[model samples]
Target: MEVPAERVEPKVEAAYRALGERVSLPGFRKGRVPRALLEQRFRGQVREDVIRALIPESYLEALRETHLEPLGDPRVEEVSFAEGEPLRYRAVVDVKPPLAVKDYSGVPVSRKEVTVTDEEVEALLQQLRERAAEYVPMEGWPALKEDLVILDYQGT
Candidate 1:
């Protein structure tokens, strides 16, 4: 799909201007810098802005012209620019193929019944007990899992 020549120019310019507003130089305030200064000071930044702006506009135009519905983001292949020239780029987009969708209504779907085992219940109870347990220093012996160590409880 191809973007119209007329629309491409304005979108590129708008992008350029937007980028220019974002770029700052030694002598200019924010959003007040001239395009030439912006171009000189932030060439790479401006080019990126142009790409960001042109791609969307181009994509939209292509979609409208070709009546193609795309699935994902388009892959940009090439982009190039020069002073006074229209921004140009190539993109590969994955478009939805023209096809008849099959009827999905009343399609059978299977669901499994879930059952909790005793072990699972015991594990859950053990976790709750651990959460409620408080650590206490053992006087002479190492602690064991089943040992219910006494603890001083406090709440705020």
Candidate 2:
């Protein structure tokens, strides 16, 4: 993806201006620092801010231009930026591959006969009996772990 000089210049200028407003240096008032001084002192920061702003926007614009819908977040590979040059960057993206379908009249498939054994039937009946069991309150016995409990309470 390449962003033109016209688009890159404004964002770089804006980043410098925003940084100058908040940074105070010796002999210069806030927001009164020269662009040259800001560039000298904070060029890396300005570049970082501009790139953070431009990369995602440029990636999306590139996708729209080429009509490519990526499957996941892009891995940005290389980035090159200069003061007056177009921003050039490369990103690796994942996309679905094309599918080619063939004839599907009679695909070979195999089947196996299913049978239930006596032990399996007995296990199923035991599970059903357990599920059908009902709870009955024991009036005189103390409740233990795994017992269904019923509590009566009043709240004010």
Candidate 3:
């Protein structure tokens, strides 16, 4: 993405004018700082600001000109800028690729058979019994705090 000198010079000048307006200098009223002075005092800053402002704009402009639609943020590098010269740069952009329409009419999908054994069924029944159990009134009997069950020992 290279912005020609003709385009960049005006923007740099505009940036200088904008900075001059906001900055205060001794013996100079606000917005009255000269362009040369601004360039001299804030040279690196002005260059940085101008380049920062130009890079994205140029990148977008190039994209539009090339008719390329990008999918993500660009990786910008190899920036080259000089006073009174064109702003040159290289941006690695991730372009949106055209996708093909997929046909699924003939696709085969398989399902695995899962078997439930007797133990599984019993476990499910036990879970249901525990979940559904509720306290009920005993008929013709007094309520007790606890109950015990007696059973014979057996092997599985």
RMSD of 1: 8.5
Segments in model 1 whose C-alpha atoms lie over 4 Å from true places: 1-24, 27-35, 100-156
| lDDT digits (tens) for residues 1-156 of candidate 1 | 344456556755676688767766788888888877766767777557666766787778778988989899888876766545666778787889889989988899999999999999999999998899986767889768888677689999
lDDT of 2 by residue, 1-156 (tens): 789999999999899989989998999998899989999989999998999999999998888888887899999878999989998999998987777999987998789999999999999998998899899979989888968889999999
TM-score of each: 0.48, 0.67, 0.61
User: Of 2 and 3, which scores higher on TM-score?
Assistant: 2
The prediction achieving the highest lDDT against the true structure is 2
lDDT of each: 0.74, 0.91, 0.85
RMSD of each: 8.5, 6.8, 10.9
Clashes per candidate (backbone, < 3 Å) = 0, 0, 0
Off by over 4 Å in 3: 101-156
> Candidate 2: deviation at residue 69, Å?
4.0
Model 1 lDDT-worst window of ten: 1-10
